[model samples]
Target: MSKINKKSMGQFFTPPQIADRLVQLLEQQVGFALDLGCGRGQLGKSILKRFPLARYVGIEKDREHFNHCANLLTEQTIICADVLEEKALSLISDFMPVDTVVGNPPFLEIPISNHLVLEVKDAIPNFLSSGYKMRSEMLFFAKSLKQLKLGGQASFILPKTFFISEQYRYFREHIIDNFSNISLFELPSRIFSGAEVSTCILYFNYRKTKNQQLTLGCIDANGDIENYLKIDSAAAVTRMDFSYHRLMSESGIRIEESETIGSIGGLIHRGNMSRNELVRKSVPHFHTTSFPINEIEISLDDDVKDGIRFGQEGDILLARVGTRCLDRQVLVTAGKRAITDCIYTIKLPEADIDTVIASLSSKYGKLWRQINAKGSCAKYLTKESLLNMPLFN
Candidate 1:
């Protein structure tokens, strides 16, 4: 156990035991490593502990935490600077040719254009006032690639959503072509502190070569690492899935990239009805809450204004609030109006919306409910997550 570093950027420091396991997996790929955005030096310290001879460098921007790292610094090099800033990166390369880069980058939201910003602010306050213009974590990945030499490996723990989100599609495609190997250690929500954000350790080598070993560690609630390609299991190991081979294995599967459907594109949108309004129009408004969902009563005097305002007939309605509306399905009509900020409206061509909704209502939808939904918690399902859904179609 460790005291939480509230002032520390991002999530709390990963517990020592988990830190040890992460380092062990990291070291199996590379000896020398850099810890980007290291806080309190726990991860950097763990690496040095396991591989006493391996060189370790930690970079932190916060002066207080940097002092903490410097106070006990031994065997590892520690520097205080913001990695996003050019000066910090220059200081880092002095210790360069870093075999690996690892850390949990900050979760700052990127700003979107005002048109979208206005739309989101009406529903999502957590979104930056300007909305997120660029993804902070993805920026770290881009910077890592710039820093690393060919064949150099980099690994970091990131929100699992990044793996499936449309926002990260470019990163994935670029890495697949550039990196010789890529491995994912998907961590379930139960492993972390209070935060319920699921994360995964993505490992990849920058160099391109033939005949590379692609290893994947599918972790579950426990910190189990089940190497599907190797048939090896860690202490908390659960079932594993993966095959060692080229980019596309002989799963005998083909998918049309263009035909792919996003939940948002499938007529799924956020639900943004406020509570007072929902209560007042409980009958006429379509709504779902953190509590069980309810149908709104439409009185004889219910106005057409209360019905659909933004979407037309056949648009799909998705609960837009935090985890409450996740996986909740609805059809949009001129008659169905949303009241809660948690609800979003998804509209598609009249010809395709019904088919898409039907698909979303099937086994895949159930799978989504089980895999992505955060149960009753206040989890925000961004359009990125719903739009990046994986399917055979």
Candidate 2:
């Protein structure tokens, strides 16, 4: 597929090996299966190979991909329709109580400002309780699970954020309250031939009640499981990403119990974006790109200054997003500066903050970041996760 169409559609065709791996994540033999957004039937083919008798149905929305699936899975049902549509979902319910549902859905957000967004979200009742910023992947996931039988299972490759970001806290709690046999882990880089986005496999069974144990894995460099642990689902509901869970499970103490960067006033706030016009005398704002940032300017305009969280001399700035440059920290100087949204700032006494920054830049500190930083590629650090960091002990 052309790179342009690939991104515009938000569909990444699964590699053959990855498809086989996803099929293997199914714990039991499949009697009936459904593949959501079954790009080119890669997963459907795997499902058939694993369970020849499994009544397989593959759904694809894109015309080209649907055509490819139609030609490839001739013996299986290939529906050429939008999986998020009510009609498509109702059709899938025909095979109610499906034994398995598998697919790698797209990860893209719908801006609430769009006129169609309200109608676009009308099909996803599960997300109604959460924020308006709807993600396509989560929509598919919620709908897929609704059709699951009592003991039915599901496996989907999802963006790393689904399991970690606080914005999706509602869904995490939903999973903890409803599923069982949950196994989640980061996939090795380059799973998609050219796409470097981070992703993980989520495999679980549907259960009316919670109390399921959760298994988390850390992938080794060679695309294999390096280490893993099992914890109660209740314990991990707030954050399902492995890194933070592992850190907290082993050594993370509570904000009240531990001496942490938060011990001294905590992270003040994320840097605000430069909202005003940058004229000759306009305040200059530094963002993730302005790293090695010398002291900068905060917007003092009536419209922006109130929201501007100024950086103090003893303040430390950390890049909040990106794959390569994330975790980059800068010690703020006395000069005035405006910070962009991509930066998180903490204010402390100069010497104390310096000591903390030095420790965070240390070898183990790097390891802490390497482990706790979520995402398979464009890794990120959450403010709560950062504030929870243990002081040098």
Best by lDDT: 2
Residue 246 displacement (Å), model 2: 2.5
**For residues 1-393, what per-residue lDDT tens digits would candidate 2 score against the true structure?**
898778776767778777777788789889888887888888998888888888888788888889998998788788888876668867766777688888788767654434334443443334443456667787677667667678889888888776776776766776776777888877766777657667888888876555668888855434457678887876676667777666666654442476777766565577655434333336566667767533322222222345566555667777777776664777765554666666778777655776777756655455566656776457778776777677644
Residue 180, candidate 2: Cα error in Å is 1.7
List per-prediction Cα lDDT, in the order shown.
0.57, 0.70
Instruction: Show model 1 residue runs off by greater than 4 Å.
Output: 1-8, 27-31, 110-132, 190-194, 210-217, 226-273, 281-286, 289-325, 328-363, 369-377, 380-393
Clashing pairs in 2: 296-336, 296-337, 297-336, 297-337, 297-338, 298-337
lDDT of 2 at 23: 84
Candidate 2 regions exceeding 4 Å error are: 90-94, 111-132, 208-210, 219-223, 249-256, 266-322, 330-345, 367-385
TM-scores for the candidates: 0.65, 0.77
Please provide, for model 1 over 1-393, each residue's C-alpha lDDT reduced to its tens digit, 9 standing for 90 to 100: 223455134545666766776776663545677877787887777777877777778888888888887776665788999876657767866777677777777655554455544433332233343234755565565565555666677767776655554444544445454665567676766566655666677777676654444566566554567544432222012211232111113322232333435633454544444657656754345555432344311222234453433333566666554453466665544454434566666667677765666655665553454454432247655565466544423
Task: State the weakest 10-residue window (summed lDDT) of model 1.
Answer: 235-244
